[model samples]
Target: MTTEMSGADILIQALNDQGVEVVFGYPGGAVLPIYDALFNQQRIKHILVRQEGGAAHAAEGYARSTGKPGVVLVTSGPGATNAITGIADAMMDSIPMVVITGQVGTPLIGSDAFQECDTVGITRHVTKHNYLVKDPAKLGDIIHEAFHIATSGRPGPVVIDLPKDVQVATAPYRRTNTSALPHRGYKPAIKGDLTAIEQAIELLSKAERPMIYTGGGIINSGPAASMVLRELVKLTGAPVTSTLMGLGALPASSPQWLGMLGMHGTYEANMAMNQCDVMLCLGARFDDRVTGRLDAFSPHSKKIHVDIDRGSINKIVRVDVPIIGDVGRVLEDMVKLWKAREYQPRDLKPWWNTIKTWRDRNCLAYPASVESGEIVPQHAIRKLWEATHRQQPIITTEVGQHQMWAAQHFDFESPNKWLTSGGLGTMGYGLPAAIGAQLGNPKALVIDIAGEASIQMNIQEMGTATQYRLPVKVFILNNEYMGMVRQWQDLTYGGRYSSSYSDSLPDFVRLAEAYGWKGIRIERPDQLEQGIADMLAHDGPVMVDCMVAKMANCFPMIPSGASHTDMILDPAQVSGVMDDEAKALV
Candidate 1:
């Protein structure tokens, strides 16, 4: 049986068939028909964002937190363009998202039509795939293909540009159970290469000091591979470290876990990577943030790279054995091989002992100036982490020092747990994202670790959160400055703090109250735990103004234009001794 439906109805039906429960979007004239069709669809909850950018970011947050394909819809032209940044942000982070944009009628294609742009061409570079639906009959297939591309291997954003005429046109719609388009470029190796797995096993069986480096791909692939990788690390008795994107791939409290690695990585993790004999890189690209100076990174290690994308194999550092396959499948095969061969590295006691010594000596050192009457951002983050430890909570953050503090201090124990703008480093991402995340996981604890300046950028989202009664806790790091940039200026620009600080800042507590949400300010370290408890205990949305030190900088910083090797150990304690020690370790 076939049913006659408008293009918008077909699109919505297609999305519903694909299990899209929520969509973040802003309506316009071009998308009126689609919104009209959506009026009665109670199954799919539509979030009306204040801006198109917020819609995109909220979609991203939903995708990142729930490991589902985030859906965003916007009107044509400027509306579509506004979402470009957020789409690119998702692309860089490899988040699964489907962006739907309304277009001017197909007849008005290139006549400088009102609210029209070449959105398909504009978003080509940023999206994994895109479709300009000129024919209303093909709407369902296009949407199906869009979601398929978005959630497939190395997942990323996909755009479907719907012309106004197409949306209004009637078409015979069939909700097919399968996608119509074949993804030729996205060929993920589902089976493991037995030869490479054997080689990896042989290497691990003999290596004394070995380490496992992971990335976001592991999480994108789901928790099975991560579990296998963690088990492998435990069986081999090797230390494991993660990139910023890979933070939640392994339990942060695991004894084998060696904290995050890269520019701001702990000294122990960086030093261990440099000193290890065997490095097992699973689904992690050697990004500049992780590898600083390519020549200086893992100089003493024999690297083995396991990645689903063949392009990433030997893209940066040379690999001794390159296994191009799904990380989960590869690890399963390796585990079988290891069990069959009974492979175990011999006499690794001394190596592990040395690593433990290094881990103890060079633990992550943040400034603990509790009695100095200055609130430290790290302390606030730690308190938050303590309040929500391993509760399967969704933590989102904005850019700058607050982001770095969350990445450095928050103990993420599993994949699809921490959400942030990593590659794009986009500010004003937190509150909107947190709202989206709360919508995505209504029962889960969703918190936005936002900076005062960043939060104000999209502060209107507080109203949206309150309207939905989304219990999202927004912890505003109230430093009254752009903390990270200010730190750079203070260190390198001879303390020339320009536009970083402003005496005139909005009262966030009052702003929350104005938005019909509960708000509180925590000025002292002693009040942090109780404040967080009270905030968490609140039934609806709440905001905590965490007043932090203005000049506080993220530690283990790799100065801009400087190599990763040229990192500051302690921003406050820039003593020559720590600098010399850092240099010597490298």
Candidate 2:
């Protein structure tokens, strides 16, 4: 059964064995053989991106949406260099991605050879791990290991640098398929810590006011643990709060949901964290953004940190009970123990009522425009949600005020349903990501809620969506400025408003039209619902330019590096500021 094959063929075979149905990449001289071999492989589809960076981001988007390792293939030198930003973006966000780049032949590695760069060294800091394939025989093993490493242990990008000679070298090929991967430095905790779990349960049973703070780890660990957390909350009657990464884990409208708790979080959620006696931190990190003024953060609460990574426990805030294990496994064990012990806390209705009163008094406040002539960003998101409510669509966003508005206003009913650039805060992320997500779930409705400034970063991907004819609806919140930074300056920095305007902005409708795609512009509020409906009804790619107020700001503001409890409900005052009418003119 031994058959000789080139490194490129082995690589393609490995990918096919891994169930990879698609790849995003660009062709170059060193990588021509790989692309040539890819031509016959009908099982895998290759998406040629306009830029190498777009390829990388598109791969990341595919991975994030599909829960599989996204693969990117690019050439050496400038091609590899162009992909660095996207690699770093994936690394910062902890997304599972594999980047395969062509390198100069082995002999030319250090001879100042043309199109030769130390891609492995350049990407070391960003990737979870990397490899240089000197031997064609080892290509399959390297690819298999890369997928395992990228998808496991917190999930991140992994790189494989392939030399041109190696791609042409011939070797016997054999596919390896298994449930486990061999990595010496990579080991994830899968078993729960029984002693710590029992202690955590005991603490919750004894506490008068208890709350669960969760994060994205819950989503990555899958829905089993998330369900357990919900059941435990219902059984114990403990209020639940989540960070931005953890929003979709608990239903937004649930009675026990206390809203997002951190900077820019609801006042009641922050107050609950400060006032609660016990905080059961599940699959969440004590990020500075979430725990502002750490010295004063949850000062009254006894924190029980449950995380899969041992290092994450006590990395920031100290923990009374540190349980190290997979979030899903730990939650399952805790649930079993709770059922056996039959432990329950007394009535929390009084405490829940108090929290509700605070929430009702000061809901996430946004000014209602009396003019009502133009379409607002919030209204666009609301209508989009309405249009896709029955389908339970997956919403992704680029990083900006529109992203924040979507986070605050969109009611996410399921876990992992909302994908965005959270930790990395990468701009130009939405469009390609939506395309990837649409590819992942062809039957589901996938939309990218993007801003004018952020959308331009990856607008070239419009062709990618069109080529695939992916039914990805792009709702461009065209405010004609970097809305978030501008909002800060207008409020805190004397309204300087430097470099935030796009006076010469391109007409997005026409820009989209240039790509031979359907484009619509919504100027008035009345056109909102119909526009969204029209987009949903269409069969192919479309972009809707939603003209929103340029000066609108994301509310329930928490100033940077400030305590969560010390949030500013209103915009900061500017000295000698003009009245609303006068400010509108500026």
Candidate 3:
């Protein structure tokens, strides 16, 4: 049954029918009608964020954590502009999200009216699909289509621009459940070609040195895909390595697990990737960070790539076999075909033995905080893991050294447990992501492992947590500098120390108090564990400022444009103006 309703009411009804439980947004004059519709809604809780960008990120966090397309609502002009960063971040990382923004009424739209800009034009490139609803009857259909496209195939952000006049205009509201969304232009491949799947299996069966290289797509495919991946790994007896975003796709404790692979990947993981004779590429695209010096990478390997998006195939390095399908389905077929054929893997014992030798390098080994009085950021992350005693504690991270350290030290045993800005490397990602994760899994212990400089980018999110009485914890590794930037300047730029230092930083403890939360500061290694414990034990939001070793650098780094073999393995090799070690080197 169709009913005549205002466009604003129709949007709310569409949201209710789509099972939208919450919306993170900031209101402005242009979106007054939508806000009026949302004002007294009980079915969908509205979270008022401090900034429009924060709303988009929080929505992304909710989607990545819950595997549901996140929804964001904002007003025109500046509100829409502020959200571009999050939209681009989601688009790059393939996080599914729908952002709805208000535009000036149809008559005012091209006249440069108050708070009017080209909302559609500004977001068109950043979104997978965008709609500027000119017709009243098309509003609900466009919203439904936006959701479908945003969550379908290689999931990404979608934008819907609602004109103020349209909101007041009457439209016929129809339930999306009864009517299928009309989308003829976009059809994504879901099942792989049978011939290609068989060919990939045969290629894997014959290869002696096989390694699985996967990325965020596996995580995005949900737990079922992760299970199938495990089955395939078990059947083949091959080693598994993942991109930074693919951390929790397989158990970190699994025997075949090589820690995260790529720029800051473990030595064993990168070494195995370079030496593999058959690269079984999974849901991951060969990102530049993962594939350094592409020509030199696995030069001897016959690469078999399986991805749902056909465009990603042969887009970077060409593959010997390309299988287009959902990773879960392809992996299931691979496992079934292997069983049906009674296939035996080519003896990979020699390859495993070589990987064991690389593991002996102890690439991740770092001194304990007790050995050095100063708190090591690595040790602090390790302590957080111990304090949680979790194989998969939901963790979000801001981009930088802390992000890498969290990936290395924490054991994410399943998908959706780890969330961070991988492709775009957004600085202010973690806090809002943590908030969204907390809302998604209300009972889970959600923490944002952040660097001081990066965390400050979205520190305002603390208000959102406190207001909602969420127990999300913000664990800051305070180095008083943009650690990664400083590390690069120290290494590549001859330690010029150009503006990298974060001087006169705010008093985090007092800042947390100002925002209505508990705050703890730990400067010494001995105080670190207790600080985290107390922060975790607290029932509400808590911020921990752990002043870590000032000069410590994240290691096992594949220097930019360098081959996997050319990594500067540890902090000892790094020299700086303030370092006595540099003086000794001179």
Lowest summed lDDT window (length 10), candidate 2:
573-582
TM-score of each: 0.94, 0.94, 0.97
lDDT of each: 0.84, 0.83, 0.89
Q: For candidate 1, write residues 1-586 as lDDT tens digits.
A: 5778999888888989999999999999889999998996888889988889999999998988888999999999999999999999999889899999999999998898988899999999999889999888889887887887788767899999999999999989877655346766656576768888899999988898888899888888888878887878777888888988888888988988888888778766877888889999988888777887676777788899988778788888999999988787888888888889988766778887887777775546666757638778888888888888867688899998888888889988888878888777889888888988888888899888999888877787777887788888999898888887787667655677888885688887888899889989999888888899999889889999989887777877664433444567776545322243333333
Q: Candidate 2 regions off by >4 Å?
A: 177-181, 369-372, 572-586
lDDT value for candidate 2? 0.83
lDDT of 3 by residue, 1-586 (tens): 5668988998998988888998999999889999999986789999988888999999999999999988999999999999999999999899999998998999999999999999999998898989999877988888888888888889999999999999999978877642365566778788899999999999999999999998898887778999999999999999999998888888988999999988889999889989899999999999888887676777889999999899899999899999998888889899999999999998889999999999999999998777438888999999999888563569999999999999999888888999999999999999999998888889989999999999989889899998889889999999988999988888766878889999889999999999999999998988877898899889999999999988788889876666677666887765443344422321
> Between which residue pairs do clashes occur in model 1?
none
What does candidate 2's lDDT look like per residue over 1-586, in tens digits? 5988999999999999889988999999889889999997798999888888888888877876667888999999999998988899888667889899999999889887989899999999988889999999889888998888888767789999999999999998877654555676677778777998999999898888898998888877777767887888778889899987787788887888878877667888888998899999988888876887677788888999988778788998999999887787888888888889998787787888888877885757665533447666777788788878778888889987898888878888777677888777888888888877888788888889998889888899898887888878889899888998788677656778899886677888898889877888887788887888888888887889999887777767656545667766765422324345433422
What TM-score does candidate 1 reach?
A: 0.94
Model 3 residue runs over 4 Å out of place are 177-179, 574-586
Residue-level error in angstroms, candidate 1, position 232: 1.1
Per-residue lDDT for 398 in model 2? 92
Rank candidates, TM-score, best first.
Answer: 3, 2, 1
Clashes of each: 0, 0, 0
Identify the superior model by lDDT, candidate 2 or candidate 3. 3
Q: After superposition, how far is residue 442 of candidate 1 from its true place, in Å?
A: 1.0
